[model samples]
Target: MSAAIKRYGLGILAIAVTFIVFVVPLLFMALIAMKDRREANRLEFSWPTNFSLVENFQEVLSARKFMLVTAFINSTILTVVSVAILVILAAMVAWVLQRRRSRWNPTINFLILSGLIIPPAVIPTIWVLQGLGLFKTLTGLIFIEVAFGLSFCVLLFRAFISSIPKELDEAAVIDGCGPIRLFFRVVFPLLKSVIVTVIVVQSVSIFNTFQNPLYFLPGDSNATVQLTLFNFQSQFTTAYNLLFMNILLITIPPLFMYLFFNRQIVAGMTAGAVKG
Candidate 1:
């Protein structure tokens, strides 16, 4: 009876904490977004007497001739392209690094680890992009995101690969399957869970990324979803209602993704853990 009560009590405490920490702020933001300009500007947690959610939504969409729409498209393209490359490339590299033992493996492993530890130098990266004639282009930004995300994805892939049976590789090779086909057909299908994990994680991060886009892919034409926030912000004045509305809109996608795929994320994260 005492243990049961303690368990119930702990659960209740966790629920209360979650409500206070996450739900409160989300509710507050929604309330503000639904409010009119004057009420939202107050930044109070109180309910608004005038709810103008539709009006604010329309205004935000039409702002700067639908820059938000453009930003959304750009962000989608960026996320899709970057994550696709990261998954395929990372998975292949991880497979090779796991299956093949070579003298150069240590050096290559060091570089991958270094990528996770070292901060990317923006100026040098920009210089290289410019030299390659990819600066200020979507292609350049795509490469930047892929490069930054590669190490983490590779590490996850390598860890998971270690647990896979080596017999699968040997059988595929004996059946006269090439390396590319073996990976694509045999291993890639098995990576669905981790792939979902990587895609969702990287997609959210890339979509929410502001600094890299701002620094590397500058200009209104190349604006991303995050940069759309600047539309409601300025030196002297800020459109609080519209800003909150924008925030509400931009935050919805990633929130829904996590809600739906949270299980897969946990499973993938714990995939290579010790069983004993």
Candidate 2:
């Protein structure tokens, strides 16, 4: 009886902790977002007497002539292009690295793993981007995101690919399938779960990313969803209510995505462990 009671108590405690940690802050932000500027600037957790939800949203949306909407489009494009490159390239690289053993395999493996450990150098990256004539462009930002996200995607792909049966590879080869055909048809198709997981995870990260976009891809025209958050602030004054509203709007997409793909992310991550 005591053990069961203790387990239940612990579960309740965890629930309370989660609520305080995540829910409380989000609720507070929502409350503030719905308030007028004067009330929001007070930074109190109290309910607003004058709810300005519609007004705040309207101003935020139309601020600087619908820049937030433009940022959303840019963010979507960047996420799609970057994740596509990361998924295809990372899966292929992981497959090659895992299936083929060679004298330099260990060295290559170390370099790939090191990408996760070593932070990207912004100045040097910018220099290279400028040299390639991709600086301050969506193409450059896409490349930056892909490079930054590649290591983790490769690791996930390698882990999941290891669980796949080698017989499939052999059979495809015997059936006169070329490398590209075998991967696209046989191997890639089987990686749906992990690929979906990667897409969701990377999409959220890239969408919320601010630093890389600010440093490598600067400009009002190139502003991402994250950069729009900064637009509500300035040296002299800040639009707290509009800022919170903007945050709430920008945050909704990723939140909904996680909610939708929660199961797939869990399944994909754990699936790799089943066979390997």
Candidate 3:
């Protein structure tokens, strides 16, 4: 009984600490978003004297003439397309690498691993894109995001695929199944759990990505949600209330996604760690 009590106490303490560390900051940000410009400058912990969520949201929405909405749409498109491509390509490549053991497999693995270590050369990438007439385009940014995110996704998929028995593939092949059909019909369905995990994790990261879009696809016309934060900053001053509101707006979607998919993400991430 004493040991159980001690464990319960520790668990409660840990929960309290987590709430203080993570939840408190989110609550504070929400509070600031609810405050007026002057109250936000004051940055008090107390409840707002006057709730201005609608007002601040209107200002943020109206800023740059509804450019935030456009930016959100751009981010949604980039994140969805890039993550979908990453998952499909990574799963296929990892499946091939893991199932087919050959002399070249090690070399290919090494190259994929190199992506994790190598820092992308921004200028060279830009120059290459310009040479190909893809610079300053959404497609260019989408491709870049995919390339940047592929290594980690591949690693995850490869690890997950490794745990799946090779006999499944062999059996399918013996049944006269081609590689493409076998993968889609037999193997891909089994990967649903890990794929959901990758989708959730990558979607959130890509949606919040700031630097790639800023450098590769700058300007209001092609701005992403993260880049839209710049609209709140100016040469002379910054609108803290509106900025916080925008931050809050940008934060909610990813937060909701994680909350909704938390179980799938955890399961997928841990599935390989324990088995593979």
Candidate 4:
């Protein structure tokens, strides 16, 4: 009875901490987002006397000829393409790396893992992009996103792949299916849960990423949803209310995605915990 009580207490404490840390800040931000400039300038979490939520959203959406819409489209394209390519490539590579036994496998595995630890070299990357004539292009940004996210995706897929039975592969091979058909038709289908988790998580990440887009894919036309935050901010005076409103709008998609796919995320993460 005492141990159960202690566990309940710890759970309650964790919930309280999460509420204080995440929920409180979000509520404050939402409150500020509904305030007018005067109340926003005060930066208080108190209830607003004058609501300006619609006005703020309108201003943010209409700013600079509706650049936020453009940013949203750009972010969507980057995320979809990047995550799609990353998922396919990462899954294939992970399967090969995990299934194929060779001395060089360790070296290749080390290099893939190293990507997670290594910081990107901005100048060198810029030079390469320029050489490839992809600088300041959406294609360039997609490649950057895919490359940066590859290592982590590979790790997840490999872990999940380990949980799969080797007999499935053997069975498919014996049935006269080529390796390509075996994986796509046989192995890939079973990876649905993890793949959904990866898509949801990485799509959110790629959509929200700012620094890579800023560096590798500059210009107003190529801006992402995160860069749209700058529309409400400036050097002289920031429109705090509009900025907060913009933040709220941009945050909704990913937040809803997580809420919807959270169970899948948890299941996929634990899929390979016990290796067969």
lDDT of every model, 2 decimals: 0.94, 0.93, 0.91, 0.91
TM-score, one value per model: 0.95, 0.97, 0.94, 0.97
lDDT for 123 (candidate 1):
97
Give the alpha carbon lDDT tens digit for every residue of 91-143 in model 3: 99999888878999888988998999999999999999999988999999999
Q: Is candidate 1 or candidate 3 better by lDDT?
A: 1
lDDT of 1 by residue, 5-36 (tens): 99999999999999999999899999999999
Against the true structure, candidate 2 reaches a TM-score of 0.97
Which pairs clash inside model 3? none
Task: Pick out the ten consecutive residues of candidate 3 with the lowest summed lDDT.
Answer: 267-276
Task: Give lDDT tens digits, candidate 4, residues 1-276.
Answer: 999999999999999999999899899889999999988999987999999989888888989889999999998889999999998999999899878779999898899889999999999999999999999999988899999999999888999999898999999999999989998999899998889989998999998998998899888888889988888778999888989999999999999999999999998787787882
lDDT of 2 by residue, 1-276 (tens): 999999999999999999999999899999999999988999899989998999999999999879999999999999999999999999999999989989999998898889999999999999999999999999999999998899899989999999999999999999999999999999999999999999999999999998999998888998899999887899999889999999999999999999999999998788688676
| Candidate 4 Cα outliers beyond 4 Å, as residue runs | none
**RMSD values, in order shown:** 1.6, 1.2, 1.8, 1.1
Better of 3 and 4 by TM-score: 4
